[model samples]
Target: MTDNQGAWTLGCYGNPDIRTPNINQMAAEGIRFTHALSSNPVCSPTRATFLTGLIPSQHGVHSFLDPKYMMGPEAYNTLQEFTSLGEVLHAAGYTCGLSGKWHLGANMTPSEGFTTWTTKPDGSTQEFYDQKVIENGQMRVEAGYTTDFWTRKGIEFIQACKERPFFLFLAYNGPYSLGKLMLNEARNRHAAFYADKPLHSFPRDAMHPWQHDNKAFHNTDAARRRMASEVSGVDDGVGEILTALKANGLDDNTLVVYASDQGWMGGQNGMWGMGDHFRPIGAHELMMQIPFIFRQPGAIPPGQTCDALVSNYDFMPSVLAHLGLGDKMPQQPKSPGRDFSPALRGQPLAGWDNTVFYEMETTRAIRTERWKYVARIPSGPTELYDMQADPQERFNLFGQPGTEETTTDLSKELEAFFDEYADPKYDIWHGGGSKAKRHAP
Candidate 1:
């Protein structure tokens, strides 16, 4: 369940109300992170950060695959020096297997240390397909729903490696569709349950320009229902994996992590998904703040909740620490994530920092224990919020008199972080800025 980097869209950590009884049950038994964040807002970039434990700028895959046209050949490649979590685990005598989406690169190769892999093609537009599984280094196609097939493959891999330790990455692609089949089901169910009441409505706080102009998936009850159904589907997939683990007697010994690639707006802040036409704004907690949970009954204490400021980059180190292989993992030059093993064990993390930073295409934000500071480009002003009073981020307090000192201090910290770890490749690609420009193709 290692969410990898998906934000609140998965309904696990960020959005507590999403139908995720399985994950909720896990959280009830284990800890649910209240303020964990991803280093980047986009998929490939954040995933790169997740694997390398470095920021997006440092990992160099700032945006998704740009193809060979405008950016040149190097733009299509992943970072050269950064090591992945799979590589580390494989090196430490663990059998590694990956199933489902492998957006890091469309071309499936052996560079990612996945000894066995069943991956979707790069930039795949198909929502469901018969995937090819790599068994003992041989590829073969298997048919089923994408999530179900990946779960089957993961279970098979576990059975094959039952005699030894293994790391199985079951990455699923669900609930991201813009289609209506699943949504219709949910709508019908809701209608049958509460026919008299007005259809339950979601709040529309701030609308992106596209959402304001479009009537398709933006402001429709169908869209909301569809999103809810998709979330439930993903949760169901998680439950399937959990069931398989318990059936095979691997539930207590294995460390399960559930997360998403990045957060989606889901019409909350007037956007549908992550990183489209809208300028990346760290406005809502749903975007930057993601869910992170760990479950290992004996190794990690049950019924724990940690309020530490963790990030996607922390995942690699945290897993390594849990497996007692931290010292054997590769060293990164500048990784901001710390091992939260103590917090997972229900011990007090007294000296842990309470601030987490999030950087997107042209936006940068710093979230402290109580305050959130965000700055966007193209004449957009910085935003500040008192999270304790306004958890939904309805109020912006930047430049206000009451929080001047806090803003100033956080701004300095943000600048220092960028100075140390800002990605040089991103700076070069975007002409020293992370802003997107309109140029004739």
Candidate 2:
């Protein structure tokens, strides 16, 4: 995200439905993990995991910050509790810079590992055209779309930092939440996208923000088209960045990590809005499974696909190991995410557990090779799906007789996984009690 940039479709994510050539090219040039999970299906928390290699429960940010603080310096200060990848890489002599979609923390000052920062402070909280950005704390509206603006700025950082190794965390806020923010408005509008079906057909009322901005989008074809356009724009930006890398001769050495903090639900699962009590959380596969692509010239074999379980939390450790700085980085005891660098290089780690655990408030899920078991705290309506048999998840085999043993086993493993990393104060499943408990301010 940065906003609601969902993986609507790309040939790589088993969706031969929509076209995303630039991203698809990256997949062809690297390894694509079929089962990459997001720690949480939201913006800030998942972004936090990228830097800490820990899920939101361990990193402290459980939900996206309130609008009053999402862009201010307070958000940055709030994230100081964890040791960031920036501090780790910056300490190792890497020039760190960030451009675009700085929703993880305070967007104003150059904090964290980035000494160079550019973002949307001058512009209102959404959109891609004629926008203003605060560059290194100074406000200025650049003459371009936001995605293009970030691509240029990222290229600038790459060209300027030729003297040293650099880590450019370029995040774009796009398909602008809901895919209907014109070329501008980029706030809650981003999450308004829905599949090209009747919104009324779903089981529940759409949790759209203000009737999807009072538009007749209501799960119309127009909404999907707008979302597709926004994704196309992001693809163009990706092309530009890869071109810039080739132009600057940094293509061979730099390791490219293409991933998303989380995914959005476009009218799937009887809900339009994402979860954590907003709708459904950790219940549908769409929200947790994100696009994970890795590209490195000779280190990782190109055009290969890996099915081992991976998640956003594992990125930090994998990146450090890939750069040969694994031993140098300090460990976060609360984080249970493992480094998949060996898997990326075509060597699966010894004793690799091919499973991933997920939670948002009281909603919990554990996904393995064939099963995806989802449960809630003190609950009813638990779901057990045979992912191998029914990828669409149309059937719930939870309480069925033949599936009882499998469901019970998954429940035990899910609890054990959370118990290992649960910090009562921050973990939504543990300290926060249940989903209903998250309704408070």
Which of the numbered candidates is closest to the native, going by highest lDDT? 2
Give the runs in model 2 whose Cα sits over 4 Å from its true position. 1-3, 71-76, 122-125, 179-218, 269-273, 276-282, 432-441
Tell me how candidate 1 scores on lDDT: 0.64
Error of 2 at 61 (Å): 0.9
**RMSD, each candidate, Å?**
4.5, 4.9
Candidate 1 vs. true structure, TM-score: 0.84
- Tell me the deviation in Å of residue 358 in model 2: 1.1
| Candidate 1 lDDT, 44-140, residue by residue in tens | 6676777778776666555555433112343333645667788888887888988766566533454567777776554322344465444444456
Minimal lDDT window, size 10, model 1: 432-441
Total clashes for model 1: 16
Q: Model 2 clash tally?
A: 14
Query: Model 2 Cα RMSD, Å?
Result: 4.9
